[model samples]
Target chain A: MPGVENCLQEAMAIPGAIGASIVDYTTGFPVATTGAAPNEDHEAAAAGTADVVQAAQSRSLFVSAVPHDLLEDLIITTAGGYHLLRLVRTDFDSRLVLYVWLDRLRGNLAVARRRMQTLADELTTR
Target chain B: MPPAVAPSRLLKQAADDGRTGALLVGGAPGGTVYLVRGAVTYAESAAAPGVGELLTVSGRLAARTWEAALEAGAGRGAVGHLLYEQGHLTQGELELCVLGATYDAAYFALGRPDAPAEFRDDVRHWLGDVVRIDPGALTRESRRRTKLVEDIFPQPGLDTAPVIPVTRAPRERVSMTAAQWELLVHADGQRTPADLAQLLGRAGYATVLELRRMAALGLIEAPPPATPDNPDFVRLPRAHGEAVNRVRPAVPAASEAPTVPIVPSGASPPAPAPAAVAVVPAQVTVASAPEAPARPPKLARRKPGARLPKEIAAEPPEPHPGADEVLLKRIRTALRALR
Candidate 1:
């Protein structure tokens, strides 16, 4: 069974991955993080990402039908990088989101998305 | 009153005594710090933000937490012990809460020297006992929060101004945490985020830091530092226009006060003082003024033949009251005449 640290390591090993973090959405706290980002405060960053995800959910028209289900994934492609947020639903109304920052030039978006989905399934089952 | 011991001194004493409890209260000259047996509980400081404000403003915990904590049984393990038993917070969250409480207490204690401080020896906070903090952990968290504020705002001058939103391009959308949203909503045109946090029951430093971050993201604007010459920059009390009017004395009117005349005996007394009279004029003014000229002339010019015929007015009402009801009514009428 894949643990939080193993999941993060797998995400970082993905082609062109720069930084990755597993965050608890309910508390906006970072469970773990792996990255080389300079002077980045992980707690605040995790909180900020959770805020963004929440805002998207609020604004999305699809929110009403799926009341208790987790958000599958979010992808934002910038000029130089790709930011992916994958939500993993767990017991006790808890959820963990994996945020992977990928280099746009070297990353294959389709493959990365598939890999994150599989990883999310593994993490949730464990 | 006792000589104020440095926080370091208190920490060392607690460590040496192998105790995890101490209560700090008040500000400056008369502030009190009590070293307790189990855990620190029921701390208050004039300068530090209150726990009630912190929890409420964070939107994480409800205000009921304060009442629950305060009302818990008193004595050695009263408040803190009860909070732990209730399982309202994880051990780590509890520790964080206490650390935050200590900082706020210290801030108030050191900031204002004239305030008196009180410490109860055996009293405890119900929720506070569930968690423990190393002095080092508390200091580290405090430093981290301080650094966060500096990193976001860069300048400390904007720390106390009312947070103002700045307009930017639509493409430059900025995101804010829930706490940040609460801070903004509470920050009318007055009260710096720090002040708002204190007023709203949130962590002052965290609120300030988040406010700064919002400002950096161009989501908010920081006004110029307040000064004697720039009094407008000072946060004004949030007074509603109606409230201001209510408190202000009404301007004296130029019209003369009407006089009251006494009536001769057997005659009804002159109308009571105008002041005592219901000021019905004002109430009717709007309705009467507009219709006066239009309605009176129209009523006078109406022809008598225009009135409805008597037969139309006397049309019989639908249905009948039954015979039993008529007899009951006649009996009641006869009884009334007899009385």
Candidate 2:
């Protein structure tokens, strides 16, 4: 029931959330963003997130051996933050990436990942 | 001011003025930029696929469903909300589609410098405002995309030219994105990126960008440059002869293969006559393609002769263009053998 705006607001409510964005990976366009970008530039952060997701999804090396398997989530832990990207699969080709930056000390990775999965599901399934 | 400012600057000025309406740009295949308050909400161009085409052509929504939404919500300027409310598409999907379409259209609509922008008051897009983009972000992204295309492959004409996949795979292995695969499967060397964008329900800019990247990867064939003097001299690929040589060794002309297709020196055209060449004879090419790997030594020995044909073909056409009749007839004979 949550629209894109409310979804981003909900993402910002997550524990230790620094920023959250929804990006179309194909064009590297940021659809919506809330909170601070890594370099104070949401465009760069979104483009970077897309590049990482695209590289992981397309390359055969990162692809799982299991048939019909897909990349679920990617985590990059920095000195003080955790950048999590969860792929959102729609009815058509999967093109959306949900990116969240969390403060390492204050945020729990396990909880954020679970919440992101639920959010992605809700966003797709209506 | 000074004739007119650039389109992006005009959009910025509109945003700075806190205007809400449509900025109707004028030019070839120009489009309208929608703004609410100060942010760009949506954009549409004749050159890029719109939201309706994105949804229906992608098979995500039926044509009837989109038409129903248009009928019901267009008057209220709430087609997006109506689609979501009717359970045709999810809110996230709607937003993503709109955002993708807007960026795609805006790249073409606002990228043109010759166009003049005219702002009309109270002309909201019927899809409703699903997402708001800052003018600065949109302009920066457009500029970045343009630069990225150049950095990947600097051919400006490839955007409008029919996408021609190379007759021969450049190497034993190459990598591409799923989008590229989709474009390749549909590329008939007749459809430009704009045409494919509507047909495939993909963003026009994304299609062009992928095709450009494919060109950089040597997977795509650049169109032969059309010089006025020798317009009849289509820069035919030398690879077709090589293709025939490998496939039909029984060709009596196999020895003469090196003599046919008199391509000008330095004009090593990459794309053959797309459909005219009958290059998709999968049964023929597939069977012989593997022979190259097994008989590497034989091909290596013939590598020196490959250089001879170009030199021989180049000088002959200059003196008497009619001399290419023999070459044309050989290519025709090869084509007949291919069929």
lDDT (tens digit, per residue) of candidate 2 on A1-126 = 777787788888889899999988876778788899998989889889989987888865676566677898999998898999998876543378999999999999999989988888788775
Error of 2 at B108 (Å): 1.2
lDDT of 2 by residue, B224-294 (tens): 54311222222223434465446564343244344346444334442443332354354456666666445
lDDT of 1 by residue, B1-339 (tens): 567654444544564565544434332211223334533333444324544444434544444553445445332335444544466443323333554555544433333333333333343343334334344433343454455567667755555456666645234655555567777677676675556756655545555556777777767775654421122211222223233333222211112233233334324444554443434334444445554444323222223444332224443222121244234434533453355
Candidate 1: residue B23 lDDT (0-100) = 39
Off by over 4 Å in 1: A1-126, B1-69, B74-77, B84-128, B167-179, B198-202, B226-339
Error of 2 at B155 (Å): 1.5
Cα deviation in Å at residue A62, candidate 1? 14
Clashing pairs in 2: none
The candidates score, on chain A by TM-score, as follows: 0.86, 0.94
Candidate 1 residue-wise lDDT, A57-76, digit = tens: 64454544555654688898
